[model samples]
Target: MHELVVTPLGERRLVLRQGSSKALQLPKARFEELRTSGSSAVPQWLADAVQARWGMDVTGRPVDDVLLLREAGPYAFSRATWELNLGCDYDCVMCYLGEKRFEGLDMDGKRKLLAVMRDAGVIWLQMTGGEPLIDPDFPKAYRIAYELGMQLEILSNGSRLHKSHILNLLRTYPPTKLTLSVYGATAETYDAVTRNRGAFHRFSRGLRMAIDAGLTLDLSLIIVRGNAHEADDMRAWASSLGLPFREYANISPTIHGGAETLPSQSPEYLTNRAPFTGCPAGVTFFHADPFGRASICKVGRDPNIDLIAEGVEGLVRLGGIAESLMLRTGGCSGCKLSGTCRVCRPMAKVFQEAKAPLENYCQHGSR
Candidate 1:
């Protein structure tokens, strides 16, 4: 038998190579021995993972391994998302859903969704829209989510949030986090991107209102070719406002509706590919549409496979979808991109339809 060895790649991640054709990964409690100077106490939590690959426990096991395999799998689904509406008041050329009402999950639909999420063990819920605040019953929906013991997040344009009722809700049932998409630093830049006149002022006021209300805030900046250089400017602005910033490569043009207004991904634009990695779709997280269909990603929803129809357990069973999409070529062999690619499959398909070795948009920073 080959000896077991450990390599510390990064602080949080440790690689345990057992000389088997396949690598055995031990994360968190699995690597406690290596962390504490190679102590010999076996981690009960990881015995399943170790025995599955090594065919033995810290001691030896005589029982059947298949029976043990049945008992272990990925973490429970901890988050649920609602893509509220496709309709948008602004026409940011890079806006993914575009300006149409591609779908709508009204109050009744949301209630059903809440129940489904709770049953699936989701304790975190997000309400997203062209602008969810535009929904008349937004506050009530948020309250219902709160009542269900789910931490909430609003993926919004941050314009209608100035309403007294909406602001009061922040003080009432604050979300776990709020992601505000800020387009530009200057009024012309912002108005041009959203294609809404006076929208800059409205969004600015709303953002300030959210800050004053003490809501945790995060800013998302869509980096388009025309707007790539502005990322730093947006970051500075967010910092000035005491908010954290994140950059998202604009995938609006690649998805269904936004295709008409923006250009498709070209080799030049593929410079931002997330380091090649396995598609972690069903493993790290699962994306479901407004109708509760399991999608490959937020931008790759197929109505044919409604997760609700399959039921929570059925959807959970498709966890291998992430592993199935992994392929390697050229310099990407043995690169970190192999595993990291799972997080950005939506953006990957935007450039080179899914199932192919394509570039991604979020590759600007190593994940």
Candidate 2:
């Protein structure tokens, strides 16, 4: 497998090395030159640059052997997130995905889905789910994506990070980043929140193991009612680990527009966010469900494009879908506070469908 991947990112291009975080920007002209350089040996300057910057001697190797070039596409996407499966070991009441169904695309389906993503110019891929590590075929699927030349990231709950196989897989490939969610600093609050006995112990063990293994990891401090009392402890613990962390206090309704998860919102921890800026969901990136159905993003999952059946050609329709979903129509038509609204239109619509309290999403509710 090639160590470096050169891919187009909209108007610019980038050089990314697997299992590493450093990136080198390439201008369009230089990129075009390299693109036309063909399957011959790696150019001396390029090889020397890689050596000088990364200290890795990739000299005298075939261009194809040292670099994987991702051709430009109509979508201009460099980032995409895939939910491998919707199954989780923990039953956190605040899960936005209400149902923890452990069903999704099989191995054959997964390979095809990943190939479509690769061809579509997706270089940054995030593999997320209820708990991706628990999937029986996670190892195979992850390896396939990694070999496909996509920079991989993982979102997990740290419950399985202690497993030998998981540690080995991550240590070998090294995702761009592994983000683990922290529910509480104490086991009592953690188990109570997840409704899973002995979950905190498992998570703690896995976290320590992952840290000891020297894996790049970050923590997402999820503030909810069950663990609201331990918020300080959680931050202190993450600080003690010397790993970067961000706090997430605002909870959302389930994907199906169910209000079941709203009760978990920690009122005291609610934070005011900046205005809702426009996003490049479909224009530059998209989210793929487990079955290979692509949507604009996680919040706007409607009108999916079936990649398995339609292939990469289906992504052509995503741009229009994103535009339509972002419009200020329907309940938000002529809203006075459009400029300062904290949530995007699609997200506001989800909150509305869930009949969530106006204070949770609407700027007027702040009055």
Candidate 3:
């Protein structure tokens, strides 16, 4: 009986709570509208297609909405994320990016990244680091991304957001999104994950400052095996703040140097996962590190290929990166749970390192 969310994927969906589970309820009427609307139309030639099937009119009306029919296809990749660093000030056990001490991206390094993204024709670029705000060039880098005609998203630990200069950027260039990580419900839970005593207050206060500065905000909570019970409380926290939230299962350990801290969730957790129709790794997204390495995922940084050397167009043609992501592997191909499985480069890396069959990380195929 709740309101329906008309997503860009051409689906008018509603979320219903059945017992302890939250189910996304979609109607048959909206599905038909999605098919007939010009706004929902997707380029038939593109391989990355979670949003491809939903057609729309010139003005962007979903076919399902236009025809008042049932919707089809999965709604995924509502957005894309790019990592700016593998380093973090805190050693969180669940973070797939920062289990070790890694250096932040410098100013010059970030400009090259922006240039590479523009050349790749990316419309959205996210700046993520051990904590992006920790890097002094964050504001300048965000502006460079915007100047390149790309909307920006920032994932920060919220430590440096309290600065007036940083707040000025939030008021001026204002990113399309700003995700602040809330590790725990209280300082004890937060400190446990961050391993820093006062991080909880800094993050909380910075978050409030950002919200007050008029930045579009969202939240992320990485759920380790030991912290699974925090799901309900996490959701409540997100709701209270009126932010779109996500609680991800920590699978890949944050790999930097020789440190790989894996989450407690095993392969069985994704056994019955939902089918992800396609991977948009190289098509809809391309990540560029501070050092100018262009990769499909952030965790693929160690041996990353340089975009400056290969060039964006050549990289896409030779990499065949996007195509590699669509193939299904064990547990993903025919699993009933395929509908909800979240596969990224990190998962792919683990599968490959273990030499597991059908492990498609980056959603891209093996090299």
Best by TM-score: 2
lDDT of 3 by residue, 109-228 (tens): 667756655555454567786677766666777766655445567887777787888888777766767878777777777777778888878877878888787788888876655455
Please tell me which model should have the higher TM-score, number 1 or number 2: 2
lDDT by residue (1-367, candidate 1, tens digit) is 1123333222333223211233455565645544453334444544566667667555342222211111111255655567666667787766666445746566786677666665565545677866778777678777776665555778888888788888898766667788888887878778887789988899899899888888888898766655555667888889899888877663545355334534522233333344444444555456666566655457545422454555556555545554433334333445554565443443444544323233233342344
**Compared with the true structure, what per-residue lDDT tens digits does model 2 show for residues 1-367?**
7789898877778888887789888888878877887777787878888987789887778887788888876567878999999999999999999998999999999999999999898888999997899999899999999988899999999888888999999998889899999999898999998889999999999999988888889999999999999999999999999999999999889899998999889989999888988988998899999999999998899989999999989999999999999998877888887888888988999998999888888867856
- Candidate 3 deviant stretches above 4 angstroms: 1-82, 98-101, 256-260, 263-272, 299-304, 324-349, 352-367
Q: TM-scores across all candidates?
A: 0.65, 0.95, 0.64
Which whole-number lDDT from 0 to 100 does residue 199 have in model 1? 88
The order by descending lDDT is 2, 1, 3
Clashing pairs in 2: none
Model 3 TM: 0.64
lDDT of each: 0.59, 0.89, 0.55
Sorted by TM-score (best first), the order is 2, 1, 3
- For model 1, what is the alpha-carbon lDDT of residue 229? 54
Off by over 4 Å in 2: 27-41
